[model samples]
Target: MIDQLLDRPITDFIPQREPMVMIDKIITCEGNTITTSFLVKSDNQFLSGNRFSESGMLENIAQTAAAKVGYECLKNNEPVPLGFIGSINKVGVVDYALVEQVITTEVIIQREVLNVTIIKGTCMLGDKDLATCEMKIILDLG
Candidate 1:
């Protein structure tokens, strides 16, 4: 069952085709809570000095949230809408994602208010959390 879930890549969900998709794999997903991983490379245009900044970490979380939205929509045969970060809250950078490290991120959808979905997520390099944020993502029709 889990194998079938991760079978399709994140590209099938979100519209990011190239040089933009940040997530590499879905480690585990259960509706509102999803865990994913990304391989950060020096070649990635978004990375600086083989490291992803705190803002980038937030972006990564937002993209991961979109992935969850896409998965649900596809499973229900509905359209996945384009989404944006509505607001940021309690964001902290404990460290930075280094080169050649596959950063794993986990996001939990806490609530939906005023058409915005609230998400709390964390980025980790191994067991150490590199960053964490509570964000609100706004959905817009594509």
Candidate 2:
């Protein structure tokens, strides 16, 4: 599974595609944490005037969490399930990302109950904080 993932883009692991796929690669996925990266570009769906919007930051964090789930599922020979952002709370956007900048996202799973996962996500550009939020992800287990 790692070999397959290594040869494909992040879109292969998550449901998002094309301009909507904010995360470019999975940096690490172990224990209860996941780290991912995305390069902000002019053609990104959430870009406005060469700047990555808050929505993109949120989605990137969510996708980072999703990437971890997807990787584990695939590694275990299970199908990748669909997931949705059920809720977001205590969101803090500290800065904006510009085109050509790479944003790194890290998410730690705080809790899981049935099909719902609660996570604390943070996005950064180098050492500068970009966004942070606590969100609930609802997985479609059917």
Which parts of model 1 have CA positions greater than 4 angstroms off?
none
Per-model RMSD to reference: 1.6, 1.9
The C-alpha local distance difference test score for the whole of candidate 2 amounts to 0.89
* Per-residue alpha-carbon lDDT of candidate 1 for residues 7-92, written as tens digits (9 for 90 to 100): 89788777776788888878887967988999887877777676887767887888888888888888888988888888989988
TM-score winner? 2
**Candidate 2 structure quality by residue, lDDT tens digits, 1-142:** 4555544578768998776788989888888998898888888888878889999899999999999889888778899899999999999998899999999999999999999999999999998889999999999998
Off by over 4 Å in 2: 1-7
What is the total number of backbone clashes in candidate 1? 0
Model 1's TM-score against the true structure: 0.91
Give Cα distance to truth, residue 38, candidate 2, Å: 0.5
